[model samples]
Target: MDGTVVTDRTAETVGADGTAGRDALNAAAAASAAEGSRSEALRTLSRVFGYDTFRGEQQAVIDHVVDGGDAVVLMPTGGGKSLCYQIPALVRPGTGVVVSPLIALMQDQVDALRALGVRAGFINSTQDFEERRLVEAEFVAGELDILYLAPERLRMQGTLDLLSRGTVSVFAIDEAHCVAQWGHDFRPDYLALAVLGERWPDVPRIALTATATPATHREITERLGLPEARHFEASFDRPNIQYRIVGKDDPKKQLLRFLREEHEGDAGIVYCLSRNSVEKTAEFLERNGVPAVPYHAGLDGGTRARHQSRFLREEGLVVVATIAFGMGIDKPDVRFVAHLDLPKSVEGYYQETGRAGRDGLPSTAWMAYGLQDVVQQRKLIQSGEGDEAFRRRAASHLDAMLALCETVQCRRAQLLAYFGQEASGQKCGNCDTCLTAPETWDGTVAAQKVLSTVVRLQRERGQKFGTGQIVDILLGRKTAKVIQFDHDQLSVFGIGDDLSEAEWRGVVRQLLAQGLASVEGEYGTLVLTDASATVLGREREVLMRKEPKRPAGRPKSERTAKGERKQAVDLPEEALPVFEALRAWRADQSREQGVPAYVIFHDATLREIALSLPADLTQLAQLPGLGEKKLANYGEAVLKVLADHGRLEAGTALEDDSSSSGAESPSGD
Candidate 1:
């Protein structure tokens, strides 16, 4: 096999400005392989794999494997990961045995290779005895290029014996992060993969997964017994998706509004926390005239498969499900991913939202976040039979997410910081906070009052308390809980009367976000940490941001358009007509294509086309959201509209400056 070999690099290596590095990697591979007297294999690799050259660090990873070094790859999804191991498999020896976790994915991979005219087969429980025997015979005859295996098969009596009989080209573990208990989806069978080295020491191994924090990374290496494996991680950020967290009083109503106005007729996933919630939410959407189906482990396998197929084949079908629906389901054009409930961790959030906008199209990641969701998720994590340390870490991550929800600052900034990366600007100008522009106040006094109350109560009752009781006592409300505990006698009891119950709740939430407050599991009570001491003593100042209550039955149009809510919309009469026409066109395209209307053309894109009226493909492609693919797909139709209106002639370049820096639409696969 001839091809350029590339190594996987850390995310930092493939920065947002990585085109130059990718080209260099491709060029270097072309040069090195030819000089090694395998110039033919290099060219063959490119031609067969449908790549002109190698991508970032792919060559290095391929070389390590071909040279017989065990490796761990942490490439992001859709980062050309398969080629790294696949190229070496073809060149190394008789048969490359790949251990994969998903049976559905195995079938898809084999089908894809067969489409490319490669001989690939999988031996698993799904195949009958005769079928397995045929595949085994083919493997013994040294005829198969790639053989995919489930880890469960490795334990069979004849499995290791047959493996020892043949030349094992390479042992590749796909979704290798499953080896770690820290991972969202852990599989015990993955632990069996480590035995491959003992069973066949000479065979090189490659383990790969899309999402893994540093902890998962370490676990993958150790559990797989590849202590010295080289590591490669791509950047975790998905810039194409505009992340938004909406504070909702009625999440179902908000979801319906999004579906009608923005995500109508789009294939999307809505994640819920329970099987019952999944069914209820799906039914709610369906009753509202949306095409949605429920998916959970409770549903029969056939129903789940039918719903999944409909979602992939047809546009605009919503699959309301638990997080279980997303693993290995690789539908790339999902327009939106809405969470009816909060995910447990940032890692889970990133992976779940990553399902949308895989086609490099602008996509909406809309989520409704609230306090109860956080509390519920934390309770679930603690309820599990885990060690105290694990529970503490899980609680910490939950607090981080809750803080993200409570922050009136840039959502992108908070999320990026969680991953240890700082965003370029204070405002992403795309999230609900940047859009709504919530109110901010110097909350130092309020924080002090809340902290003091927690401390005073601790001294009085010798117990932890919940938020309701604390807030009631702070606001000087004579609630039964407060009266029963005689919290009224505390020095801080009547001091917080200046703030309303709602206002004090905000203060308490912010305190939690700041890590000054924590929930004690043993007592189901709020406890002040040592960090709260300074604040309570007036040594530190605290500030708070809160959202103004949304007006009842307020129309969305009256709602501000985020960044330019106050900016004047000045338009010429000619431009107004054209803008309406553009909207009409988008609506029609969305209906015909069965994708979200934004998928055809986001509002920003429509504004650009209305102002510029680009006459040809070359100019349209330059506009934001109108990539080469989109231009090729809809170029003629768009230009024809402009031509009919006599706006295509003398195309003038209007100011490209729009309220949004990037076009917001659904793209990615």
Candidate 2:
């Protein structure tokens, strides 16, 4: 903001002798200023954003981007991806241009930055012409620190010309996975973003995403023309979210039980498969005394915005939504994300469930999946109006999702392996499969019988049968179709008579997952693949675990999420009310200030304040989130809240105060 360092394009030229003398002095001053600004990035991180240090992969990302090098960042949903670009945007000179995908997210990002006293603005269709001109004037005058724009606006010539006139510092492309054709969140506008490399060849460009596979990663770099950019990949694993999949039987009742018993009065998201389901589920929850709202493409924009606003500001608001929501939600305390229907792919499931437990607390990724999901997904993948390659890819992704759902090994390990990271031996004790440790049975004989039946049926009838008919024949059930086909006389028909329907289903699902068998055609006809030969010939053995069944309307007895929980802030029982009061204060302030509550202070910080009960503004400022400006602004109120709570706990045990211990909470495993 100093005027001496400001560059002028039309200034008059000076004499060589005078210029030489001035240039030396200017170079010295610039060197000193650069060093100061480099350090200022760290200072501002604490003073403005209220963080004492950079998180994992954040400081390195900031250093790389601040040094004017391009970077490709792949971090988890709550992994502090914003700070990687934000810190550098502040440390580097000129206004930071961000290409955001959604208008709703643009508003939240601007509000959050403004809350931290950063001069941030956004340009999008939501703004009128006059508003756009005002932001443009401020941007051209270099009064803005960060200006977010929709991808379409960024590709416009007028916007491009405007950027050419100013010292544009950095270009940050959020949700860079949108450029990949095979990704679920693909957007055509992102394809135009490759021009950023050509237009501003010297400006450092950073592409960031919370969801990406190895294939998607390659596509993003190629599309964005960032093949040579520095790369920083934080672990894609969200360990705070405990993965649990239950068989769907009376889903509405099961969902109610989960809410009433485990997560009563906690905020969460219920993802449904259709708009009707979203609306119906919202109504169902409301009828059962749980406050709920619906969100989808069918709802009016005004209604959607209101619902989102309430979900962000209010506590215990359940949003039953289709896949239309939760892409860029900034709410940090979502305790759970429940899937009423199976997601289309593993990437979508991972990204959606990750919206929960962003604060490094124990959260849940629960799903009620069943055979119907597999049928519907298979139909969609097989009969969709796409090319052969696209359909095959869809089938592949669906198969992978099914594998994760039915995997007997660690769910986290299976998921990480899909993204090319191996973790076979590193067990995550949080997931349901890992927690229960189900018993396995030698399924090699069952696999051989099933494969032989498929081969016999194909050889005799010149076609295979669906899973239902195949199961009927295997169980020796003399159904009408079985008798008509004379399948009862086959050698392998009665060989599987000992297994139950559920057990046979498990074996079949495992066969499909392990690539020993495949399903073909619209009827889901069972067909044998190459791997079936090894199993049929006794060269490779097969083992499978029976999938556990869930009670229709009862909650699990484990009290791990909220009760018997392990969170970053461990306050004593006496300090619980004070923590709640601090949260109430934060919510009220967030409403009045029109920003997300975490923008003021995270729940972890409030918990610390309640436990330690800081006596004055000075003690409060010593906390990680209470920086200089915030100390001057809300420090007194925080102190009052803490002082009142301190008196309430004055007779409590004389525990050591640790709200300002200056040690960071360790990240999840």
**TM-score for each of the candidates:** 0.71, 0.85
Query: Which runs in model 1 stand beyond 4 Å of their true positions?
Result: 1-54, 63-68, 91-93, 406-440, 452-465, 469-503, 520-524, 551-669
Top TM-score prediction, candidate number: 2
Give the per-residue lDDT of model 1 (tens digit) for 1-669. Answer: 233234443223565788857776766675565445244336545445433456676777777787778889976555667777777778777788988877755665675455444678989877899999999998988988899998888877689988887778999998887888766788888888778988788889999887777778888999999987887765565666777776656888889887666666667899999999899898899899999999999988789877876675455689999987886656556778999898877778877888886655556788876555655665577677789988877877777777777777887777767765677788876666666566788888888777777777777668668788888877788888888888888888778887777577767767776778766574447777888888877788787776446622223543324333111123445676577677677667755754445446545566678888797887776565554446666779888877866644333322233323235533421
Give the count of colliding residue pairs in each prediction. 31, 0
Best by lDDT: 2
Model 2 scores a C-alpha lDDT of 0.83
In model 2, the runs with Cα more than 4 Å from the true position are: 1-35, 422-425, 449-465, 476-497, 520-539, 549-558, 561-569, 646-669
What is the RMSD of candidate 1? 11.8
Candidate 2 residue 363 C-alpha distance from true site, Å: 1.2
lDDT of each candidate versus the true structure: 0.73, 0.83
Across 2-74, the per-residue lDDT of candidate 2 in tens digits comes to: 4454333112333556674467557656666666766787898888876778888988888778878999999
